[model samples]
Target chain A: MLEVRGIQTFYGNIQALKSVSLSIREGEIVTLIGANGAGKSTTLMSICGVTPPRHGEILFRGQPIHRLGAEKIVTLGICQVPEGRHIFPQMSVLENLEMGAYLRQDKAAIKADVDEVFERFPILGKRRQQAGGTLSGGEQQMLAISRALLARPTLLLLDEPSLGLAPLIIKQIFEIIRKINAESNTTVFLVEQNANQALKIAHRGYVMENGAITLEDRADNLLSNEEVKKAYLGI
Target chain B: MDSEYFFELLCGGLVKGSIYALIALGYTMVYGIIQLINFAHGEIYMIGAFVAFIVSGVLTLTGYGGPTVLLLAAVIAIIYAAAYGYTLEKIAYRPLRAAPRLSPLISAIGASIFLTNYVQLAQTPDFLPFPELITDFDFMEPFSRYVSSVDLVILVVTTLTMIALTVLIKYTRVGKAMRATQQDAVMARLVGINVDRVISATFIIGSALAAIAGVLIASRTGQINSAIGFMAGIKAFTAAVLGGIGNIPGAVLGGLVLGIAETLGAGYISSAYEDVFAFGLLVLILVLRPAGLLGKAVKQKV
Candidate 1:
C-alpha cells in the first residue's frame, strides 16, 4: 500500500502538482485518469523520487520513502516504467531485463523471474538477443513492462503504457496488466489518458485536472457518472 | 623511403599512439557518461607523471634503482591518480549534475586551470628529467635497430591495458550498469543502479589509465613540465572527437590514426605542419561521415 499526502511539486516557477493526495490499497489496480499536463506523471515521479515533492510526504507500507533517492526507492520495491518507454537503446533485451533485477542478490530467483516474464510475453522471448531499441513501439512497451516486472516490485507504477501503441497492442498490454495483478498480486498505480479502458480494469479511479484530484470513486460508478461520461468518456 | 626506415617510423608512431590512446579513453568515457569534456583529464595525467617523479626521487634517495623500482613507481602513480580522479569528480563535477550543460563544462575548464597552476606552484615550472628506467635492458639489442626496449615496454603495457579495459567494460556487471547509465540515466536509476557511483568509478578508472600514459610519455621524452598537459589534452580531445566522442573503441582508433598521420606527416613533409595534417584528416572524416570511423549514427526515437 502507498499513501501520498499534500504533495506539491514544481518545475522552476511553475507548479506541476498542487498539494495532491491519493492512496492505493494492497493488490488493487488504481488508475489516475487525466488530460494533458494534469500531473499524473508528476505524481508517479514524485513517489519514485525523480522529482521529489517540494512539500509532502509519501509513505510506502507505512514507511516514509519521499526523502529517499530514486535508486533507493527502487530497492524499497517501488518501480516505475517511465513515460516514453525509456529502454536501454543499445543493450539487448536480455540485458535490459537483467538491469531490472539490479539490486537483487538472489541469482536463482532473478533467473526464474526473467523466465516468467518471457513466458508471459512470448514475443519478447523470441527477440531476447535483439537490441531493445530495434523493437516496435508495442514490443518496446512490453519490454518496458517486462523489465519492470523483473524487478519483482511489490508496487508497480506504469506511466502511459498505451501512449503510442495500436489499439490491438493496447488491448494485449492491458490484458497482461490485468493478468499481472491477478496472478502476481502486484499493486499497480497506473496513470493514463485513456479513461474508459483504464476505469474498466481499475478497482478504484481518480480523475485529475489542473494538478488536483477532482474526483474519486469506484470504477463502475465513475464509468457511468454523467459528468465523467460527458467530459472524459466522450459519450 | 626504405622498408627499414618505414618499419622504424611505424614503431615510433605506435609508441606515441599508445600514449594518446590511453589519454583519449579518459576523455571519451567521461564524455559518454556525463556529456562533459573533462578538460582537466590532461592535468590528471600530468599529476601522474609528477607523482612518478616524486616516487622515483624518494626511491633513489633510498638507493633503490632497477626495473622493479620503476614498476613500483608506475603502480603508485596509478593509485594516486585514481584518488585525484575521485576527488576531482566529487569536487568539480558532482555539484553540477543537474545544472545546465555549460556549467559542468566551465567547471571542467576551471579545474584544468587550477590543476596546471597547482602543479606549477607545488613543483618547479621548468621541465624535470624523467629517470631512464629501461636503458639497462640490452635484451632488445636484436630489434634495437627498429625499436628500443622502452618502446617495446610501452607497446606491451598499452596492449595489455587495452585488453583489460575492454574486458572490464564488455563482460562485467558494473560495465553493464555503465552502459545502461550511458543510454538512460533515469531508467538506470529505476533499475536500482547507483548512477553517481558508476560515474565516479568511470573517473577513477579513466584517470588511472591516463596516469600510466603520462609515465610512458615522460619515459619516452625524458622530460616533463607543468604546462605539458594543455597541448596533450587538446590533442587527445581531438582524438576522442575524431573517433566518435562517445564510442570507446573509436577513441583508440582515433588516437592511433592521429599518431600515425602526424608522425608520417612530420617525416615526409614539413615537420612544423604536422598538426595541420592531423586536423585536416579530422575535417575530412567529419565532412564525409560526421560520425567518427567506428561510431555508429544513432537515430533518436520519439
Candidate 2:
C-alpha cells in the first residue's frame, strides 16, 4: 500500500532520481533492480523521507508521506532496513531489536513481536546478549532484518540485505523474507543488485536506470527477458 | 617537607582533585555520547553552589539546625541545579542535535556566558560566602594534621558520586541507550531510541555532578563568585583532556593527577603559574599517549 509518481531527488547539484514512479500493493514483495548509481537507493530514501523528492508525490496507505520527517514516516508503519546493516555496533543484539519498537507503546505487543523475530531467526535468540558489531556479515544482515521486523512495519523497505553476505546466508535471508511476507502479510519493497534472487520472490518488479523506471513486468516474465538477461543476469 | 606535612598536602590535593573529577565527569559524559564539550557545564556548577548558598542563608534565617541541616539543604540545592542542567540541555542543546558540532559548541559557550551573567545579576560579582557546615569538627586536627573536615567531606562525597555514576552507566537501560546512541545515532533512531531523550538525560546527569562539585568547592574555600567556574572549568577541562576527552575513568585519573601536580607546583614554585603546570601536564600527556593512562587508543581506520 505505497504509491510513488514522478519524483525527482538530488544530492546537492547532482540529480539522483529523475522522474521515477513505481507502486507496491498490499501484502506483496516488490523489487527495484539496478546497477550502481541507478537511483534505486535514492528511490527508497525518497519514499521514506530521508531525502524528500524535490518534485513528486509519495503516498503511504493514502496518506502523503513525502513531506514527513524520517522519524514520522516510521510512525506511519513504513520502516527501512538501510544499506550496510547500520547496526548500533556497541549495543547487544537484543538492544538493537528493542530500538526497532522505540515508538510503540503497549509493552505486551512489543514483547510478542520481539519473540516472533527471535523465532524467525533462531540464531539471534542464542546470541541476543552479544554486541551487534561482533556479528559476522551474514549474522549482522539477519540482525538488521530482525531489527526492522521489531518495528512491526506495514511496509518494510530493505536496501540490499545480501550485500557482503555469503551465498548460503543470502538464500536464508530470502527464505525468511518469503516467510515474513507469507505469515505477517507485510508489504515489502526491496532494492537489490542480485537480479535473479530478487526476481524469484518479487511478485512484480521494476528495472531502474539512471533514476528512471525503464522496465516494469511480472517477476517471471522479466526473469526470462533477453534484454534483462544481457544487462542484469549476464547470461 | 616532613612525611606528615607531605601526607597533609597529599590529602589536600586529593580533596581538590575530587572536585575536578566531579566536574570533569560532566564534561566527559557529554563528550562521550553527543561528542559535545558542554562548555556550559561549569556554569551549571556555579549555579548549583549559588543555589546552595542562597538556600543555606534562608535556612539559617529560619533557624534550621547546624551542619546536618546544611547538608540536607545542599542536597536539595543539587536537585534544583540538576533541574537547571536538564532544562539547559532541553532548551539549548537538544535543538542543535542535528546541527553541526560547532553549532552546539557555540551554543554551549553562549549558554555559559548567559548563565554567568544571570547569576552575576542575581547574586553578586564579588565572592559570596559558602555556609560553614562543619568547620568546628576539624577531623585531621587530632593527628596534628593540616587537613580539615571540609577536605574529608569533599573526598568522601566525590568518591561516592563517582562510584554511583559508574554503576548507573554500567548497569542501567538508559546507559545502554546512551552507548547505543553514541555508537550510531542513525541506527539508534531506527530502533526507537528517542535519541533526544537519552541525550537530555545525559546532560542532566552531568550537570548534577558538576553542581555537587561546585557546592563542595564553595564550602571548602569559604567563598565563590560568578567567575569561580571559569578557573575550575578550565582545570577540569584540562583534566578531561589529559584523561582522554571521552573516556570516563580517564577523567577521574586525569583530574587527580592534575590536582596533585598543580598543588605540588604551587607549593614548591610560584602560585601564580599554578595553572600553567596543570595545563602543561595535560599537553604533555596528550602528546605522549594521546589516550591517557587508562584509555585505549583506538587505531583509526585508514
Candidate 3:
C-alpha cells in the first residue's frame, strides 16, 4: 500500500534521488539493494517526509503524503528506522520505546506493545533502565527495530539493520524480520547492502544504481540470473 | 590574618558564588537540553526580584506577623520567577524552535533586550531598594567589621538553592529527559518527548533558581536597577562557561572560583577593573580546556 513516482530529492544543488519510482503492496517484504550512495536511504527518507521529494508523489493507501512532515507521516503508519540505528542514545530503552509510540492515543495498547517488544528482545528488557547508547551494536539494532514496532505502523522502513552486526546476529535479526512480517502482516520496505540475506527474505526485489531502479523481479529468479549472480549474489 | 577573617572571606565568596551558581544553573540547563542559550534568563531573574519586591512589600506592609516572613518571601519570589521563565519560553523560544539556528538565538537576544527595556520603563530606571525585612540594618555585627547579617542571609539562601538544584538534575525523571533531549534533540523527538515542553519546564526551573539569586543579591546590596542584570548575567554566564557550560555542578564551582578571584582582584589588584578579573579567568581557563573545567569532550564520527 505504497507508491512513489518520479521523485527528485536533493541536498543543496546535488540531486540524490533522480527521478526515481517504486511501489509496494500490503503484507509484502520489498527489498532495495544498492551500493553506497545509490540513494536508497534518500528514497526511504523521501517517503517518511524527512527529506520531502522535490518533484514527486508518495501515496500510502491512496492518500498523498508527500507534503507532510516527518512526525505527521509517522502518524499515518509509516515509520523509518533510519540508517545507523539513530536510537536516542542518552534515553533508556524504556524511554526510547515510549517515544516510538508518541503519536498513538491508546496508552493500554502502547504498554502492551512495549511488553511485546521486551518479550521479543528480552535483552532490552534486562537493560531497560540502561541508556540505549550503552547497548552493543546488535542489541542497539534490536532496540531500534523494537522501537519502530512501538509506533504500531502498518509500514516499517528498515535501513541497514544488519550493518555492523556479526553474522549470527544478522541471521537472527533477519529471522525476526520474517517472523514480524508473518505475524503482524506489516509491510516492510527494506534497504540493504547484503543482497543475499535481503533477497532471501524479500518477496520482490529492486536493484538500484545512481538513484534509479535498474532491475525489478521476483527474488528467486533474480538470485539465479547471471548478471545478478555476477553483480550481487556472488553465486 | 585570623581564621575568622579567612573563614568570613571564604563564607562571603561562597555565598555570592551560590547566587552565581543559581543563575548559572539556568544558563547551563537551557544550554544542556537545547544547546541554546536563553539570554532572556537574566531578565527572568530580574522579574523574580520584582515579584519578591511586590510580594514581600505587601506582606510586611499588612503587618504579616511571623519571624518566617523572609522564607515566605523567598518562596513567592521563586514561584513568580518560574512563571515568568515559562512564559518567556512559550512566547519567544517555542514559536521559533523549528527555525534555523541563528533565528531562535536572535529571538532570545530580542527577548532579553525587550525585558530590560520593559522593566526599565515599568520600574523607572532608578536604583530601587530591596525589602528591609531580611536586611535588618538595626543589628550590627560582633568581631566582624565588613560582613553584615545581610550578607550572611544572602549566603544561606544562595547555598540552599544550589543544593536543591544539584539534587534535582541528579535524581529526577524530568531531569533525565532533559539530559537526553540535550544529548540528541532529533532522537529525543523520535522517542516521543515533547521537547519544547521539557525545554520550557527547564527554563521555568532554572529561572526560579535565578530568581532566588536575584532576590538574595538585591537584599544584600540594597540597590538594583535595570543595568544590574547586565553585570550579573555576564558574570553568571561566565561562571557557566567556566565550569563547563553544560555541567550543573561545574557552574557552582566556576561561580565560587570566579567570585573569589573577582573579590581578591578588586581588593588586591584593581577594584575599578573587578570585571576584568572575571573575563580574564574565563578566557584563560577556556583557552586551556575548550569545554571548560568540568565539561567532557564530545566526539562525533562521520
Candidate 4:
C-alpha cells in the first residue's frame, strides 16, 4: 500500500504538481487519467524519488520514502517503467532484464524471475540477444515492462505504456497489465492518456487536471459519470 | 630501405600504438560514462610515471633491482594512479555532476592544470631518466632484429589489460551497471544501481590503465617530465575521438592506426612533420566521419 500527502513538485520556476495526493491499496490497479501536462507522470516520478516532492510526504507500507534517494527507493520494492520506454539502447534484452534485478543478491530467484518474464513476453525471449533500441516500439514497451518485472517489485508504476503504439499492441499490453495484476496480485499505479482502455481495467481511477486531482471514483462509476464522459471518455 | 629496417619501424609503431591504446581507453571510458572529456586524465598518466620513477629510484637505492622490483614499482604506480583518479572524481567532478555541461569541462581543464603544476612543484621541472627495467632481454631475437624486450612487454601488458577490461565490461555485474548508467542515469538509479559508484569505478579503471601506459612509455622513451602528459593526452584524446570517443574497441583501433601513421610518416617522409601526421588524421576523420570510425550515428528521439 502507498500513501501520498500534499506533495508539491516543481521544475525550476514552474510548479508541475500542486498538492497532489493519492493512495493505492494492495492488490488493486489504480489508474490516473489525464490530458497532456496533467502531472500524472510527475506524480509517479515524485513517488519514485526521481523528482521528490518538496512539500509532501510519501509513505510506502507505512514507512516514509519521500526523503530517500531514487536508488534506495527501488531497493524498497518499487519500480517504474518510465515514459518513452527508456531501455538501455545498446544493451541486449537479457542484460536489460539483469539490470532490473541489480540490487538483489539471490541469483537463483533472479534467474527464475527472468524466466517468468520471458514466459510472459515470448518476443522478449526471442530477442534476448538483440539490443533494446533495435526492437519495435511495442516490443520495447514489452521489454521495459519485462525489465521492471525482473526487479520483483511489490508496486509497479507504469507511465504511458501505450504511448506511440498501435491500437492492437495497446490492447495486448493492457491485457498483459491486467494479467500481471490478476495473477501476481501486484499493485499497479498506471498513468495514462488513454482513459477508455485504462479505466476499463482499473479497479479505481483518478482524473488529474492542471496538476491537481479533480476526481476520484470507482472505475465503473467514473466510466458512466456524465462530466467524466464529456471531459475524458469522449462520449 | 632494407626489409629489416621496415620491420623495425613497424615494431616501433606497434609499441607506440600500444601505449596510446592504453591512454585512449582512459579518455574514452570516462567520456562514455559521464559525457565529460576528463581533461585531467592525461595528468593522471603523468603522475603514474612519476610515481614509478620515484619508486624505482628508492628500490635501487635500497639494493633492490631487476624484474621483480620493476614489476613491483609498476604495481605501486598503478594503485596510486587509481587512488588519484578516485579522489580527483570526488573532488573535481562530483560537485559539478548536476551543473551545466560546460562547468565540469572547465573544471576538468582546471584540474589538469593544477595536477601538472602540482607535479612540477613537488618534484622538478627537469626531464628525469626512467630506470632501466626490462631492456636487458632480447625478446624478438629469433624473429626480428629490431623488436626488443620492452616492446614485447608493452604489447603483452596492453593486450592482457584490454582483454581483462573487455571481460569486465561484458560479463560482470558491475560492468552491466556501468553500461546501464551510461545509457540512462535516471533509469539506472531507478533500478537500485549507485550511479556515483559506477562512475567512480570507471574513473578508477581508466586511471589504472593510463598508469600502466605511463610507466611503459617512460621506460621505452627513457625519460619523463611534467609536461609529457600534455602532448600524450592530446594525442590520446585525438585517438579516442578518431576511434569514436565513446566506443571502447574504436579507441584501441584509433590508437594503433594513429601510432602507425605517425611512425610511418616520420620514417618515410620527415621526422619534423610526425605530429602533423597525427593531427592531420584527426582532421581527416572528423571531416570524413564525424562520429569516428566505430561510432554509430545516434538518432535523437523527440
Best by lDDT: 4
Model 4, A1-235: lDDT tens digits are 8999989999877999998889999999999999999999999999999899889899999999999999999988899999999988888889989898888899999999988888878888999998888889999999899889888888999999999999999999999999989998889999999999999999999999999999999999999989989998899
Candidate 1 Cα deviation (angstroms), residue A195: 1.6
Question: Which residue runs does candidate 1 get wrong by more than 4 Å?
Answer: B136-139, B297-302
**lDDT measured at residue B166 in model 3 versus the true structure, 0 to 100:** 64
lDDT for position B75 in model 1: 98
Residue-level lDDT of model 1, residues B136-227, one tens digit each, is: 46778899877888889899999999999999987888888889999998889888889999999999999999999998888888999999
Structural RMSD, model 4: 1.6
Candidate 3 structure quality by residue, lDDT tens digits, A1-235: 9999899999878999888888999999999998899999999888877678999898989999999766577777888788898877656889878767766779899999988888878889999998777888889889888888988879998998899889999999999899889999999989999999999999999999998889999988878878877887777
**Candidate 4 chain B: minimum summed lDDT over ten consecutive residues — where?**
B135-144
**Cα lDDT of model 1 by residue, A1-235, tens digit:** 8999999999877999998999999999999998999999999999999899999899999999999999999988899999999999888889999989888889999989888878878888999998888889999999999999888999999999999889999998899899889999999999988898899899999999999999999999999999899988999
User: Weakest 10 consecutive residues, lDDT, candidate 3 chain A?
Assistant: A68-77
B192 Cα displacement, candidate 3 (Å): 3.0
Q: What TM-score does the A-chain of candidate 4 achieve?
A: 0.98
Model 1 residue A200 CA deviation in Å: 1.4
Each prediction's TM-score versus the true structure: 0.97, 0.86, 0.81, 0.97
Best by DockQ: 1
Candidate 1, residue B165: Cα displacement in angstroms equals: 1.4
Candidate 2, residues A1-235: lDDT per residue as tens digits? 8889899998877999989988999999999999999999889878877788999899877888899777788888888898998887766888788777777777799889888878877888888998777788888888888888878888999999888788998999999888889889999998999999999999999999998999999999999999999999889
